[model samples]
Target: MQPEIQLSNSTTQLESTQNKVLRNTYMMLGLTMIPTVIGAYMGLNINFAFMAQHPILSLLGMLAVMFGMFMGIAANRNNALGVVLLLGVTFLLGLMLGPILQAALHFNNGAQLIGMAAGGTGAIFLTLSTIATVTKKDFSFLGKFLMVGLVMLILASLANAFFQVPVASLAISAIAIMLFAGYLLYDVSQIVHGGETNYVMATLAIYLDIYNIFVNLLNLLMALSGDRD
Candidate 1:
């Protein structure tokens, strides 16, 4: 009886610790958006002509920088520095949004499209996360598929950068939305199911999922519904 009681207490403590980590992750995720929004607002004013003139080079450069940050975050994942690096990454990504966001605003109903994309992304994030929670299924299974889709996404995006095909661009954006939606499920499920124990890393994963969803959803809406004026 005494051993059983101790085992139960140990299980309860482990659960309590996990809940604390989850809560901290959510808090950090919320904090990250402030810097991201600020960076995006600043990005809106900057000239993106350089990107247009040097599209391929710019894309590769951005990828390199992103990879560096990923490594930095991974190295520091268990520390406060990881949170700092993650926020820095989000800010840089927000700045990168300048080009697309600027393009969206050129359309007649651009503002509406942006709002719709944001709303849709939010809806997906919430719905998928809720499902993961209620079902409590281990979504680590999705990691391999998501990684493959990510590789394909990068290749397609790089190709479209040069080819500039409208149909292909739209298709890529659509695929991206689905891929990141899968990531959202996989990420949130990881947090709930103990596959990921680090809140900092969890927040980073979920944030990227939402970011890609918003960007691609906005692109798709612009393609399908934009009033060219």
Candidate 2:
């Protein structure tokens, strides 16, 4: 009886910790959007002609900066600095969106398509997160598969950067949407199942998932439904 009681208490405590982490992650995730929006707005006014002329170099430089920031955030995950670094990363990512946003805004219904993409991404995230939280299903099994898919996706994207194949670009965008949706589920499930104990890290993972989903979804919409002026 004593052992059983102790085990029950431990389980309850674990669940409570997980709940707190999830709540904090949601709050931090919300806060991240403020900086992201600000950065994106600023990006719209900035010139990116250098990137246009050196696409591959620009891609490599962006990736290097992002990777370094990710490492910094992870290293400081237990402290307030992690939160700050995460926001910085998001801001940088938002700035990176300038090129795509510029392209979209060239179309007559660009703003409309952007709204729809945001709505779709929100719907997908909410649905997957709800399913994960309510069902309490372990999605750790997806870790390896998702990693494999991500590598493949990266390879394809790099190839297309050189090939400049329009259809392949569309395909990559479509695949990215689906892949990131799966990541949303897996990330939320990690929090629910206590697989991710740090709220900052969890928020970062989920945030990235949502960001990728929105970017890809917007790309798809722009490709398929954008109206030219």
Local distance difference test values of all predictions, in order: 0.89, 0.92
On residues 83-103, what C-alpha lDDT tens digit does candidate 2 reach at each position? Answer: 889999999988888888888
Residues 139-168, model 1: lDDT tens digits: 889899999999999999988888899999
Q: Which portions of model 2 miss their true places by more than 4 Å?
A: none
Name the best candidate (by TM-score): 2
- How many backbone clashes are present in model 1? 0
Taking all chains together, the TM-score of candidate 2 against the true structure is 0.98
Candidate 1 regions with alpha-carbon error over 4 angstroms: none
